[model samples]
Target: MKITDMTSECIGKCLNYLSFDDLLRAAISNKKLNNAANLIYEQKYRSKRVEMHILSRLHSNYFMTENRFCFYSLRTSFQFLFCFGRQVNEIHISYIPRYVIPGENGVQNENNVELTHRAIDYANDYCAESLRTIKFTRIQDASRYMKRPFINLENLEFYDCNFTDLVEYNLLNALFPKVQKLVLKTINKNLDQPCTLKFIEGRFAHLKSLHIESNSYSKFHHADEYCILKGNLVTAFRLNPQLKELDLDLFVNCHVFQSNDVLLVINYLQNLDSLSLAIDDTFCSLLDSSVPPLMYFRNLKKFSLNMQLSTESRAIQFTSHQLDTFELHGVDRFTNYEYEFLEKHPTITKLILRGGHFERLNLSRIAAALPILEQLMIFDHFKLKIEEIVPHWSKFQSLKLLCFFHTKIVKDSDLKPLLINGWHGRFCNSPNKFQIILKR
Candidate 1:
């Protein structure tokens, strides 16, 4: 039999036993073996091309044949990747100036402004042929570059990129007019105000997920000016009517706490299936609020909130029917009012609490509130009164995967009783149903 045929038969029979490295080693014996290996590893050809590119940088002496290396130069790895997928489903492209420096030797940078048209043509060709999800980040001028319409592209993401003005946003409305998922993350929040509003009206009319984050890594001269425009997430959501999930992180400035803009966001996204927020300390209204009457994401399952500034208290009231996983971080204290709100929810299956230093928490009351919580994580340093928490161990009957790390309570003998009671013969008895880990 031919070497390719023999290799294919062997792979079919012994794929579980032979690793990719083993196959490569076997194929390096002769020309017949090389051909057989190429056929077997064709799906990973781009990765192999990138490996050769990195090797060329590290060791100038190394070289590969045309078949081993992609047709484009090392600078156009993404370009080569674009051509490889015959049925393109998703295309995510991002540019960071540092990563796209001109080649030192004789190679040209394919990502330069002059060559971007060629890249767009490549993208257009693929999208025209098949359904595509196109996501771009750090494109210097997206509104001008992405002027043409795409027929088969369904989802679009623009992150930390530059755009000219509302005129450029008109171009986005023209392109991908049927986008079902829209995400925009930008540094110059003012530059694309109209573009953002237009997107909610044009493309995101039926958006399934809408995510927006501020590129606040850069310092601004007037720190407070961008707070209203940048931090007002409610304004962004109000523009969209059919959004199912929203993940927003906005700066908390003096004007953000109970602003009308925030009310607009809460009103629009009240029915989201998943929500994630990282906000500043100025917004204390986050602690206590009933679920919006118009919004009941009967399917809303995951929620995470990371408070950037230390707040005296925090609380959240939510329905337990669809909530299975929850995570809360960076709050100093959970007030009695907050605890009482959580006490009402008895069906959360997984929970995580991190960076908490409060010592006055009522452990028994907290445990009694959550009847179905299975996985619990109290990570990174948490100081608690062991005596107060240890006695309430029996309340958690369905408990599993308790991760309490970097805490003074880990060394206490009082915790041993709860540990033994919660985990003793339970894993074998429950069979991967329960586990507790203590890290200091």
Candidate 2:
């Protein structure tokens, strides 16, 4: 049975079983294998997602034949788009300064601005119809390219980008009127002059998700910055009234947000299915207050709360009958009342508890509360004997996966109960779903 005597289907099946690197190595062995490898490579990567970093110099022949390319540089990106525009679906452009000093005689260089304009013109001319998403990072003059229309672009993300003024910020709404998802992170270099979201005046009618975050941590910001951020947030809520999912991690300190402001924002969001809020102790106090009821978020199916400070009085209530996923982080302790809240929300099938202090009793309470939980992740500050907690495992009727990170197991017999109960255990492992991690 010589290799060449095998049928084409058998040979292909053999090649398909080989890893990509092995296939390339086999290609070097013979002409028949080389042809097969080329066919496989093209079939695998031709229409796959492509990312190209176009920083320094332009290479003429570099990505002329690739498809679905995500370009990072300005001039080279424009050239690549000019050549293979129809094949591209996503593009990322980051401005790389060529000068030794950023500013010349107190005025920033305009050459980068001009290059950006040219890139925008190229994108508009060549790939406007096929492009689906565009991301701009570390951009100085964002308004220059943002003023142009991207006909079919559905997603836009900005990271560490600068917007000089409110007018430039508003130009984003005008640039991609049909955009469905928008993500903005660290939008300003000067914390004193943070990009204001107050000007976002309901421009995106089709937007389904909006994510906004600041570069500065909540504890380090000044009073004035918090004031501006809060005002801008209120304005954002008013502008995008039809959003279905909102992720806000801007204000790290709860003191920055008043109880009424929190109520106003949550109440304004009518049909949201998912909400993620990262706040400090003061905001948690507001949730425990009577004014803004938890009923405001009763329609959410997925909810995440990342607390900044540890407090025993922390209370949060979710009356959402449809909520199937719940995540809580950075809280030190879960009181009996809080556990009771969880017991009421049996609809939650996926629960993630991170950075919380939990003993055997607390773990038992959690297992008893959410009997229908399918996926559970407990990371950091969880100290208990596995044998002591296993007695409560019978309560988890629907659990399929369990994970522990940086957890301490006090006794060797801690895992003996799990092995007896048909649960697999793994220690110091990597990337396996059915394994339970224990740190002795």
Candidate 3:
């Protein structure tokens, strides 16, 4: 039958199976095919295309001309958004010039400021209506333009952005009144004071997840910085008591946070289901002290710690019965205290260990303790002889997923038994085959 004789349903079904590039090519073959391609493109292809178009312009100076729309500059990119922004669900603004020349006392230059203001205006006017997620990186004051509430925005992220003044902070709170997920990375070292959430109480009532990271590695060198960060965290938790997940990495190093401060924060986070703390202090003291028991985290299902605890504090016990996932880091050796702690969490089915010194005996101990563990991830910096450790696999009958990151395999033949079922980096042994992943 001739192509024109095919029904529209048949054409659409055939076009749906074609790859995007192939559909574009097929569109030019005939008028019938062109109409079919356009129908499919409008329904399934347009949104992703617009998102990529906007991202490409923001990340690079590359330009593309399509359908009489030219995206040669940042201005034209906004113009593209003005027409098709509804198709874009997420927006990322990588860098906004500070408009201040170095060595000029940080005074704002009128010319550059005008350019930034115009870009911000275009972004706000065109894209804010439909964006669900917005990320800003290296922006001097993104809150200046984002002061208005974004009705549709649910996820917001800021990396190396300045909120130096109360006005900026207030604007930020107003910008995403309905945000459910927020990620903040404080890396600007020039700020006189660290960002704090003391003024925004009851503002993030709907927020469910919060992640704060101190991208400034140098901040750990100063003791006072940790105090400031801890204060900020306390205030943040108080303001968002409804949060279900909290991840904090303030670049804290040994002896930064006292045992009391850590317990205080944990007490406030009873509602959290997942908690990741990267404070570089010893949890041993907290466990040994009269502070509330680990049972304070009643609802916590997943816990991650990247700290060093004294092996001397062997009396520590974790009684969070609901916890199913446990992650430990910065452990060079598996001491008796550590083993004792894991012995209490026999219900844990997922475990991740990083920067840990793991020997055959340690693996055997973990397998014996967490017999039902289904997923295991080990990120070791030191070289590991997988050949010598393969014999231990028999102990992990419940393990279904095993992953290794940044670990050097001493021998390639060690993976031969696991790879027998599949050569594509995935292997299954038999009735209870498990997947193994090794990353260098």
Measured by lDDT, the strongest candidate is 2
- Model 2 alpha-carbon drift over 4 Å, by segment: 1-54, 57-75, 96-121, 187-192, 217-229, 254-256, 282-295, 310-313, 357-361, 406-416, 420-422, 429-440
Local accuracy of candidate 3 as per-residue lDDT tens digits, 272-316 = 999887744353455555754554578889998876544422433
Candidate 2 structure quality by residue, lDDT tens digits, 1-440:
87556776676668777875476466666666655655665566546554443333332212333454444456545544554465567766665554222233444322345565566567667767777887776665565654357777899887877666645455566667788998888745353445555445455778889887774434334777577757777877777778888888765643556555767776677678898887766665667657546645657889888777655635565457778898887776677656876887878898888777765446677777787888887766654445555667677767777777424422445566665445666655344222355221
True-vs-predicted CA distance for residue 434, candidate 2, Å: 14
Cα error, candidate 2, residue 384 (Å): 4.3
For model 2, the run of ten residues with the poorest summed lDDT: 56-65
Listed in order, each prediction's TM-score against the native is: 0.64, 0.73, 0.70
Higher TM-score: candidate 1 or 2? 2
- Per-candidate alpha-carbon RMSD to the true structure: 8.7, 9.4, 9.1
Per-residue CA lDDT of model 1 for 224-302, tens digit only, reads 5445344434444566656777777655443333323444455566567787766665554544446422223456678
Worst-scoring 10-residue span by lDDT in model 3? 49-58
- Residue pairs with colliding backbones in model 1 are 234-265
